[model samples]
Target: MSAAVHSERPALLVTAADLAPQALALLRDFDVVYAGKSPSDDDIARLCKTHNPEAIIVRYGKIGAQAMDAAPALRVISKHGSGTDTIDKVAAQARHIEVRAAVGANAAAVAEQALALLLACAKSVPHLNTRMHAGHWDKASHKSVELAGRTIGLVGLGAIGQRFARMALAMDMRVLGYDPYARDVPPGIEVVNDLDTVWREADAISLHCPLTEDNRGLINRDTLARCKRGVIVVNTARGGLIDEAALLDAIQSGQVSSAGLDSFADEPMAGGHPFQGHERIVLSPHIGGVTSDAYVKMGVASTENVLAVLRA
Candidate 1:
């Protein structure tokens, strides 16, 4: 007997960089259109129009109303990571498009990255290593700070923030978490709804909150002024959460001792961004959730989310 005739698979647009093969395997029945890494909203709109995809998987960059309008048949939008600010949920919801994120998929990885940055800042890892490589023993000049007795303030107490809090607690540090929307605070973390409390109490501050209009300049000069002198800062959240100019000024003025940054307001941080050549800053190219394991977990979750929506 002749084999059953196969039908053309529905199309899925993916914008992440070098998506995991396993994810594509999970989506074996779908025709995927991969936009290059960091595709603009306009790029998304254009791609959606050209491909006529039923769903879109955003790895990075914003998916706005324009992109949503471009795909008349678009049924769902999925994020590879937990953050949904990059996607215009209101616009998606207005048109009856469901939005899903790979929640908890990259939480551990992102938490680990935040901790790594915190440790690097506390111990002055980058500065020491750079000086050591330059043939300077500089140990006496740059002493490492101990994490055991310090207080860490977390701006968000979601999965990633909670994971990081546990790690910090294991190191004998005190954790203060500020999440206005969280239902319960994790064990060993002191929950504070007031932003001032976290800002005033923490020796080290790490941002894990989503970017929103209200919290965009959460860590500006005025906020930094409230923090302890020489307080270490780490951000694994959206870069726009902190005001760049204010952060730079604070760093220069010694209000902020050091910073560990993974996200930035303008990514691919242009040639003359102020953070460059700063000895006290540890900058990463936005790879907090880009670890190998996280990629697979996020990928699988993203693909499954799309399929769930499309098939439902």
Candidate 2:
């Protein structure tokens, strides 16, 4: 028999940075290799060759074919969040590597943030807070619309989107969903065939789609023009789906009333970004899935996937 088929136990590599205490405890059970904050492809290659990990659990970084080539024995890869755009899934599948992620681990956190943004946009939250803190009582600027009896158009109706739909329904809001692959619409949601109709009809629009070449910058000037005037937008999913330049222009021109963004086109966003001082946009450093519960759930799921592949 060849040496390629002789390895017995599987080693695992974990490239996540600053793991919570509970996550660390669970990950410690495996024969694991670690790396600094953002390990380069070469660094990852070196580590994989040295450890020969059968599984790798990574977060928020690219894992291309080169990285996978470095570990000939790797059988599985686990992502810490729902978004898998960071990893090359096609390459992994070609290598017989099973890729898995915590599908709904951060659904509640994301839904909460979406609601917060919707309410803030409807009621002018940041604006009023600023005035109150500056010792000015201005009720005029605080006049806002209620969330009840409004339509919310959700682009993707996956796990997180379903959760948001339920929440919106509970708040007495009409939910409209547009997902080409969605098999069934929830009890309260109205499923639409095309996206342009949702863009024109919804009072608020929240995106939950993956970032792919087909949908990159889908929300451009033309789409913005189709959206209802003063439509509030929220994005807890990938950043490239919406054209940032078009969005900024809409916000300035009173087309897009407000936006809540958890992810950006470029993460660790550059220092002097235009949206930094904009009160109409609420930004949260890509922390939609950073809660302790999500961390534990992801750690457990990833560890389970690793162990399954190792035993196989």
Candidate 3:
């Protein structure tokens, strides 16, 4: 832990203000640099130029080609969570740098968040709470949707999606899943070959897939139009999956009953964004995987991924 010894060690850059103590303890041999929260591409590039780190742990910002080029010694970019959409994979590949994700590290946390959002939307939790706070009880007139016999369509059957499916099944709800790459899906989930089947048959739809160019804006006007009327939508995965404008239109037209969104197409969704004041849309500032337990798990997983490549 001496300054001289730390200076002699290889550097590792973490794109976050702090990491879990458990993860930090594992990096005792490295000189770790902390990039303050909300670092931009230029800030990360500047840090890379200064530190010349052997590895980078992506937590809060996008890592571009410039940042990768700035660090000639960079061999790996490890994601602190499951999503790697923020990392420039093409640039990493071209530079012969490896990109790894702490897959399933935050599965439980994210799955729980998805469930919370789904339930909130189904039962009108937020709207009811607002009415209660304002002393305008309309309990006699208000009706909540029950979930026991409902069918929920899940997109992406990864660890997080599977976990949420189990929870939904426990509630006696039918589950329909659509994932082209998923194999050996758990029992009780009816796997559908196409998205059209999911949209047509499901009463509610939840997204749990990664953001990719092929699937960007997957839930758009056309897809929403195919869905059953008054269908509930919940997105706990990537923001780019849903077209915000189309979703707002669907909500306004009553084609979609309600929405629970954790991630947005743009991070730190600017003030006065269109989705801000909607009563039926519940929003969280992309904190689905930010629980204390998941934070420690992700940090440890990301650190281990870094060490794996560095020690290879």
Q: Which ranges of candidate 3 are over 4 A from the true structure? A: 1-6
**Which is superior by TM-score, 1 or 2?**
1
TM-score of each: 0.95, 0.92, 0.98
On TM-score, the leading prediction is: 3
Any residue pairs clashing in model 1, and if so which? Answer: none
By TM-score, the candidates rank as: 3, 1, 2
lDDT of 1: 0.88
Worst 10 residues of 3 by lDDT: 1-10
Q: Give lDDT per model, in order.
A: 0.88, 0.81, 0.94
Per-residue lDDT of 134-249 in model 3, one digit per residue for the tens? 99988799998899999999999999999999999999999999999998899999999999999999999999999999999999999999999999999999999999999999
What does candidate 2's lDDT look like per residue over 99-200, in tens digits?
987677777877777777777778878878888899999875456878899999999998889998999999999999999988766788899999988988
- What TM-score quantifies how close candidate 3 is to the native fold? 0.98
lDDT sort, best first: 3, 1, 2
- Lowest-scoring 10 consecutive residues by lDDT in candidate 1? 1-10
CA shift at 185, candidate 1, in angstroms? 2.8
On the 0 to 100 scale, the lDDT of residue 222 in model 1 is 88
Cα RMSD, model 2: 4.1
